[model samples]
Each structure stands twice: as C-alpha cells, then as structure tokens.
Target: MGPLQIKNILQTSPENQSVTVKGWVRTKRESKNAIFIALNDGSTIHNIQAVAEPGQFSAELLSTVTTGSCLKITGQLVESQGSGQAVEVKIDDILVYGTADPESFPLQPKKHSLEFLREIAHLRPRTNTFSAILRIRHALAFAVHQYFNDGGFFYLHTPVITASDAEGAGEMFRVTTLDLNKLPRTEEGAINFKEDFFGREANLTVSGQLEGELGAMALSKIYTFGPTFRAENSNTTRHLAEFWMIEPEMAFFELEDNMNLAEDFVKKVITYALIHCKDDLNFLQNRLAEEDKNKPQNERSIPLLEKLSFVVDNPFERLTYTEAIEILLKSKPHKEKKFQYPVGWGIDLSSEHERYLVEKHFKKPVILTNYPKEIKSFYMKLDEDGKTVRAMDVLFPGIGEIIGGSQREEDYDKLLGRVKEVGIDPENLWWYLETRKFGTAPHSGFGLGFERLVLFVTGMSNIRDVIPFPRYPKSAEF
Candidate 1:
C-alpha cells in the first residue's frame, strides 16, 4: 500500500501487524536510546507516531533528520503510552525519501507569524495550521457542490471572457489579444478598442449574475461556480484581484424566496464542513491550545458543530437596510468611534457598519435587504417603496458581506430605464435585453464570494492564506 492515512490506521486494529507508511516528519523526540517521530501525510490532520529503537537506528542519526523531511517507515503497530497520541509503531526500518537541510529551510519546530508564512507559501501546507486550513478549504468546496447538487440546482458554466461589464463598475481586468505597439487607432489619439477580439472591448467577468439570470429564464433554477476577477486595486483583508464566486439564480422567485435560499445555502455549507472536517478542526484546536496556554476552556477551538447546527435549525435575523442603519446609529456601542463617512439615510454601509450590525447588534447572521437605488446594481428591481431597490446583503459575524443578492428586473422598459439612470448605455446590453423580451419570470439570485466563504470556514485571517496562489494589488507572487 502507498502512504496510509492516519485515520485508517485506527481502523486497523490488528496489533503487531507490519505496515509501511510514508509521510513528512512533523516533530521528532529522542531519548538516550530511542526516538519518536510524529508523521503526517496530507490525508488527515492527526499525526501518527513512529517509535524508533536507537539500538536499530542511532539517536544521532534520528536527531540529524529535520522537521518536514519526507521518510518511509516499516514498523509493527503497537499501542502508544505517549501523552500526545493513541496508537504508535515500533519501527524496524527507516528510509529517507527526501532530505531537508535544516540550515536553509525556514520551517522548524516553532510558531512563525502569518506574515513570515506568506513569504513561504510554497511550503506552508506542511505546517499544521496551513494543513488544517487547506483541508477545511477542500471540505467547504465539496460542501458547496454537494449543497447545490442535492438541491436539484443545475450547474451552469458561463463564459470567462465577457464582452459586457455586467456590474457596470468598470472594474474589469481587460483581456487583449493584440500587439499594443502596432495597434489600431481611431481618428482621435486614443486607441480603437473596438478593433480588438470580439469586435469590442472584452474583459474578464466580475460576476456570473447576468449570465445566470439568462439561464434562470429557461432552466427555472441554475447555479454557477466560477472564478471572477476585479481590478479595483483594493488593498484589504477581504479584497482580492481574482477570487471564486457562487451565484444561484432562480426564476419565479421573489426577494423572500431568494433570502430563504441564501440562508439555507449558508447553513448547508457550514453543516457539511462541520460533519466532514471535524478532524481538521480538532487539529486546529490542539494547535491553538499549544499556541495559547490561556485559551478559554469553555471557548470551542472549533465551533463548527455548535455553530452549524444553530444555523440549519434556526432562522436568520432579517432586517431592512434602513433598520440596520438605525441599529448602527442608535446603539450605545457606537458612542466611542465616530464613523468616518457620515451615516445618512442613503449612503452605502461601510464594513464597520456591517460588522457592528451583525456582530454587536444582531449577534447572528443578518440579511440586510432593500437598499437604496443609488447604492445597488442597475438590474435589481425597484421596490414598491420607490426609494429602495430590491437588494440583500448577508452579513456574518467576522466577515461583513459574504453574499449580495437581488430580485432582477423582468420588465424590458424598466431595466433599460434603470440602466440609463445608472449612467450605462442600454444599447451595449443588446443580447441581455432579449431575455426580458421573450419569456421573463420574477427571478432572484445572489453572489457569494468563494474566498470569503473559505476564509470564514477555515478561520484564516487573510484572504491570501485561503487561496493556494493569491493575486492581489501589485502582487501575484508564485
């Protein structure tokens, strides 16, 4: 057998059975005549023990091996008496597969800051913290697919290189296939972008909502999970140049139906990760205990179980955007910090406002709905109130807005007028108008930032750490 997963070993109750396992050394402890190596494969967060007899393998030889060195050990399964683990192996054979020179390798048996770890992103997965993060990330991704698949949602793949800027924010990273040095120019000094591929300026998609709306008109229910790009140049913990987004669009659904779906979707994902990723979360717990001796005994290192059960079983706190603003402004907690941007009746909610509402005021995930027309997207339906558009933003405790959704404009005239009101040309959205013209239904959808969800699930502090290869402002370091 290849490298055996640590979880599978507990199932292997056959004591004294000889087995070969291959993994990297996490920690190695040596006595006068014996050595114990904690080995871990990518399979599980739990580390396995390999007890080496110094009579067979010298203590000097074992001590020479550094942390993160890959090795294969042939040993007999034995019950461990050590404080750290349950089952251990008495190693009869030890073979070094890959050697780690301790002098140059930055990773050692010590805690490194998150900043230092970012510099060594290539090898950070071998660390316990990152290993758990990656495992949670993988589990959450699987949960997202499973939730959609089990719910009878059609998985739709949309085009990446889109001719239209769906958000109309002009935040697209332009896609070009021409030599700029020998470029076509208009009568003016500016280059003619119309001569580019697709006969017009095309760029990467920022959101799959527009295309998803088209699919929903036909498919009735459709979901798209794909990579999106934003060239906003925002340097923040939550911002990324490129990130994943999951958009679910449903036809014949109102704003209430959309809010229900968003709530269920979030709950389902958290539940799935809790069930599937318990071991990884436990590993993180132990790491936390080791890192902070003063960690609360009652405070759960992994709140996945308790947190998710509450989510699935309970109802999300739903409040109108106006209600949330009132809570933020009236709260006794807001007395200390004066908000930089004036909190008014129509301005967009800042991250501070969002966090305060969800974390302090509600103490649960809050769905802030019916935002002002000036702050929301053009495609969102104008509410009966006239002042507000049908927009909903789901705010979690740690992250402000994980999801943004709205009921789309089914009326062609209204949509065209809204686009024009938003200072965008309706003529440019030629094919998009066809959906409203043909067969239109009351459709609703939401866009959840995939990296943000991953960060929330993995308990990762920075967006860069959640993604394998992060792209941010002025940086795409491999």
Candidate 2:
C-alpha cells in the first residue's frame, strides 16, 4: 500500500493500525530509552511525532536523522502523550532516504529572519513560516477559479508575446533573436527589426486586457490569469519584474456594472480564505502580533483576522476622482505640508494619496472613478465632459490600488483619435480598431495584481514574501 500523508494520519483513528509514512525530519531529540522525531510532509504546518525505542534501529542509521533529513517509517499510529499534538507514531522500522548535515545546513531549528531566508529561496519552503504562507497562497488561487466559475465566467488564455503594448507605457522586455555581433541595419542606419524573429518588434506582454477584450466580444464574458512582465527597474517592496495578473472582460457592461463585479469578486475570495485557511492564518496572525510588539504603539495595525472580517462584511465606499481630490486638498496632511506630491485636479494620484484615502479618510476600501483622460489609458471610454474618462481604481487599506479597470470606448472615431493623441500609430492596432468598427458592445474590465491580493490576505508586508520565487530588478537566482 502507498504511504499516507501526515495530515490524514493525524485526523484518522489509526491507533494500533500499521501504516507507512514518508517525509522530511524537522527535529530529533534523544531521550533516556527512546528517540523522538518531528516529521513533516508539507501537508500541514503541524508535525507528527515519531518515537523509536532504543536498539530498534542501528546507531549509525539513527545518527543521520538530523534536521531536514528525508525518511520512510513503518509504524503503528497511537495517541500522543505530548502536550501540543493529538497523535503520534510508534516506529517499528526506518529507512534513511537522504541525510542533511547539521553543521552545513542553513535552516536550523530556531527562528530565522525573512530577509535571511530570501537569500536561500530554494530551501526557504521547508521553514514553518514559508510553509504556512505557501499553503495559504494555494488556497487563495483555488478560490479565484472557484469564484469566477460560479459567476459563469470563461477562462481565456492570452498570448504572452505580442506586437502591441496594452498599457502604452512602452516599458516592455524585448524578445529578439538577432545577434548583436553582426546586426542588420536599414539604409537610415537604424537597427532592422524586420530581420528579427517576428519580422518586427515583439515583446513580453505588459497586460492581457486587449486580447481578453477580443474574447469577451464573442464569448460575452471571459477572464485571463497568467504571467506578465515589465521592464521597469524598480527595487522597492511593492515592485516585481515578473508577476501574475487576473483580468476579466465582459461585453454589454457599463462602468457601474464593472465596479459591482469587482467588489463582489474580491469579497468572495477573501471569505473563502477565512473559512479554509484558519490555522495558517492564525499562525501568521500571531507572527505579526509578535513583530508588532517592538513597533511604536501608533504604528501597530489591528489584528489580522479582524481586519479581514471587516473587509468581508462592510461595503466599499465609492466616489468620483474629483471628489477625492477635493477631500485631499482640505485634509490635515495637505494643510500641514505633509504630502510630497501636490494634490490637484488633473495630476495623477500617488501611492501616499491612495493609502491616505483608504487608511485614514475612509478607513475602508474605496473605489475612485472618472479620472482625467490625459492621466489614463487611451482606450478608456471618454466622459461626456470631454476632460475625464470612465476609469476606476480600487484601493485597499494596507495595499493601494489593488485593481484598475475602465469601460472601453466603443466609437471607432473617438478611439482612433485617442490612440493618435497618445502618440501610438492607429495602423499598428488595426485588429483592436477593427473590433470597434464591426460590432463592438459597451464592455468593461479590470486587472487585479494576483500577488497584491495574496499579500493583503496573508497580512504580509512585503510582496516578495507571498510569491514562491520572486523576480526583481537585479535578482533572478534559482
């Protein structure tokens, strides 16, 4: 028979029943007449204790059972006499699969700093903190698919390599096969991209919204969940060179319907995690509490579980961007000269302003809509006022701008004019322009940074800690 996972063994009434288990050894201690070992298999944060009698196995075999060692044990599951655990295994035989030397291993039995663990990304998953985080991450991802499926949304796979930039930021990683040693050039002394792999300039996609719109035009409702790349050289806690995005587009939907869907979707996913990941969340809650003890009293945050419950139960505040700008102008921060960026009518809102609105003024998530057209993407639906577009940004308490989306312009002439106004050639986006020409409906969608959701749900301060392997400006090791 196959070996049972430690999680199932602990929950089952397998007392006096022989079972085989395989996992890595987390810790080992020698008693007067027995050897006690804590075994973990990444199934749960809790470890199952395994007790071996003296002389049950050879001394040489037992000596190699240090921290991080892999082993297979055949034993009878019995009630544990220990204080924390409910059940344990009484080992009858053991086989060492691999041994980890105590003197050379980086992960010891003590608590390690998150910054230190990041250097060894490959081995960090074996730690308790990382293990719990990864489990919660998986649960959140499952909830994403479940929520969308229940809402009758089709999953669409968008292309990773494309000839157009959806955001129009021009910050994209180039994909080329041309050799720099011997490059082809035009008569104008410019590099000839026609000789490249795609016969023109191609890049890793910055956003999948454009392709998702094409699918939505036919399928009515579709979503894309995949990796995206950016070439920005930002080395902050919030920036990553590569990340996952969740973008959902729907045909025949307006700006109000888009905002309603975004709110419902976020609440559903968070509620799912609260019910399914109680233990892991509790561990993280306590960990954050301990860390908060050293900080100033005013800077400490509320309990993690309570904060999550508040978001799930309450309704998000909604207002126009112009109203938000007015509030910021009269606020204490602006009067006291605290804001680094000036607050005005047409300027783009910075992170500090976003956090202040959600964390200080409203004290909840806020959806600000109708941003100035010059500050937003060209494809956003133009407002009747001719100065603003139907753009909305969802701001969470700790994390600012968790989602950004807008209603797409359906008028071909207006969209083409906006495209030209943004300095992009209309000929280059012939396909997207054609969608509006033939049969375009009033569609809208938003892009949610998957990592930011994980970061907010797990109560993690840094974005890197939530992802398994983080890619940043100068670091891509492992």
Candidate 3:
C-alpha cells in the first residue's frame, strides 16, 4: 500500500505493523538516547510522534531533520508511552525528501500574529491554526453543495464577465482589451466601448443572483457558488475586493419562504461543521478563548463552540424593518448615543445596528425584512404602499449581515421604472427585462459571502485570514 496519511496512522491500532508516512516535520527534539519528531501531513490538526534511536540513522541525516523538513519515514506503529498521544512510530528507515533551513524558516513551532501570517500567506497553511481552519472551510463548502443537491437545487455556472450590474452600485472591475495608450474614442470624445472586446462596456459581475434567477424561473430551484468582484477602495476588516458568494434562487417562493430557506441552510451547514470538523473546531474554540482573554470582559466575544451551538439550536427571530427600527429607537444604546451612525427608517442599517439586534437585543440570529426600496436593490418586489421592498438580511452575532436577499418583482413595468430610477439604461439589461416580460414568477434569492461564513465558523477576527489568499486594496500578493 502507498504511504498512509498521518490522520489515519494516528487512529489505527498498534499491531506492530510496518507503515510508511510522508509529511513535513513540525518539531524535533533530541535527547541522550532517543530523538522525538512531531510530524504533520495536513491531513488533520493532530501530529504523529516518530521516535528514533540515536544510532538508527546517520548523524548528518538526523541533523537535517529540522522543522518544516519533508520526510518519508518507515516505522513500526506501537502504542505511545507519551502522556498526550495514544500511538507513535518506531522508525526503522527514513529518507529526507526536502529540508527547510531552520536558520531562515519563518514558522518554528511558535505562536504567530495574524498580521504577520498575512505577509507569508503562501506558507501559512503549514501552521496548525491555518491547517485546522482550511479543513473546516473544506467541510463547510462540501456541506453547501450537499445540502443544495439533497434539496433538489441545480447548480448553475454563471458568467463572470457581465454587462448588467446586478446591484446597480457601479462598483465593478471593468473588463477591456482596448489599448489604454491609444484608446478609440467616439465622436463625443468619450472612450468608445464599441471597439472593446464585447463590443460594449463589460465588467466582472458583482453577483450571480440575476443569472441565478433566470435558472430558477425554469428549473424551479437553482444555486450559484463562485467568485464575485467589487472595485470599492474601502480598507476595512469586512471588505474584500474579490470574494466568493453563495446564491440560491427559487421560483414560486415569497418573502417568508426566502427567510425560512436562509435560516435552515445556515443552521444545517454550521451543524455539519460541528459534526464533521470537531477536531478543527475544538482547536479554533481554544484559540478564540485565548484571544478573548486579552479583551475587557464586556467586550469579549462568546466562546466559539457555544456561539455556534446557540445559532443551530435556536430559531432565528423574524421581524420587519419597521419593527426593527422601532426597537432600535427604544434601545438603551440609541438613547445613550453609543452607535457611531444614527438609525432611522429610510437610512440603510449599518453593521453596528445589525450587531445590536443579533448580539445585544435579540441575542440570536435575526431575519429583518421589508426594507425601504431606496436602500435595497431594484429587483425587490415593491410593496403596495410603494415605499418598501421585500428584502431580507440575516444577522449574526460577531459578523453583522451574513446573508442578503429579496423576493423579486414580477411586474415588468415596476422593474423597468426602478431600473430607470437607479440610472441603469434599459437597453443594457434588455435580456433581464425580457424575462420579467415573458414568463415571470414570484421568485426570491439571497447572497452569502463564503469568506464571512468561514470567518464566523473559524472564530477568526479578520475576513482576510479565513480565505487562503485575500484580495484587497493595493495588495494582491500571493
């Protein structure tokens, strides 16, 4: 058989069986008679101990087996005499595949600051914290597809380059092949997009929701999980220039259906992580506890595992935006002017407002619906009062708005009017408008930032840490 992964080796019974394990050396200790090497293959958070007699290997070879060195070790598996671990390997043969110079290697079995890790993102995955986080991230991603597949939702691939601005926010990365040095110009002296690659202005899509809605119209249920881009220059903990999104659109679903689906989806995935990624989650929970110890008692976050359990066990509180506003107005923080931004009916709710509802007031996940039309996207179904739209936002404790979605307006005239009001040319979105004109159905969908979900589950403070390579303002290093 091929070399077994460390994860499996650590779980097997010691029958004095000979096995070969290949992994990087995490730590090495030398003593008078024996050498102990802690090795990890990134199969799991735990490392396997490999014990070697002083004369088992050449002195030069043993000296090169420092931290971060790659090795292929053949040994007899036996019950460990160590206090913490259950099993260990008694090395019979060893080969050095590669060596990391301990004098210059960055990770040396020491605690590292998150900011410093960001600089060495390419190497951070070798660390325990990142390896555990990456494992949980994989679990969560698998759970997302599995849940949708079990629910009969078709996975649709949408175009990354689109002309239509889904959010109408004008914050998009322009896609062009035209030479900037000598750009073609129209008679009006404007940079002519007519000579561009797609024969018009094109950009990286801000969402797949619009295309997802098209699939849902015919397929009944559809979902999209892919990269989306934004050109916003904001440098904050919550912002990323490029990130992954999970969008699920369903036909014949109203506002209540949308809210219910979002809640169940979130709870199901978090539960999956709890069950499948127990070891990784336990590591993260401990890490979060250490982080919380430094903050003031009142400012510290709830324990990671407990917070996740709370979300899964309890039903999310559902309330309308108007009702949410009234509650906020009566809140002690509002009266004391503790919020950085003022809260009112027409204004869009900020992260501070969302956390107040989830962390302080409701003390659970919250689904706030029926936001004012001005603050929501144009496709949301406008209420009969013509003031609000059927929009919903899912709020979590540490992270604010984890999901945003709405029931779409099936009325073509209203959608067209809103498109005009939002300053988008009707001709640009003619195909989208045609859908509303032809076979329109009551549909709803929501967007979940994939990194944000990982951040919450991993108990990570910065959104940058959860994702493998973070893309942000003026920084695109791999």
Candidate number of the best lDDT = 3
| Candidate 1 vs 2: which has more lDDT | 2
Query: Model 1, which residues run further than 4 Å from truth?
Result: 1-3, 58-64, 285-313, 334-337
Q: Model 1, clash count?
A: 0
Model 2 TM-score relative to the real fold: 0.98
lDDT against the true structure, per candidate, is 0.83, 0.92, 0.94
- Global local distance difference test of model 2: 0.92
Candidate 1 lDDT over 302-353, as tens digits, reads 3544444545666779989888778777866565556665576788888878
lDDT of 2 at 461: 88
Per-candidate TM equals: 0.92, 0.98, 0.99
In the range 263-378, model 3's lDDT, one tens digit per residue, is 99999999999999999999989988888889999988888999999899989999999999999999999999998999899989999999999988999999999999999999
List the pairs of residues colliding in candidate 2.
none
User: What residue pairs are clashing in model 3?
Assistant: none
Relative to the true structure, candidate 3 reaches a TM of: 0.99
Report residue 305 deviation for candidate 1 (angstroms): 6.3
Predicted candidate 2 versus true structure: per-residue lDDT over 19-94, tens digit per residue = 8889999999987888999999998888989999878888889889999999998889888877888888999888
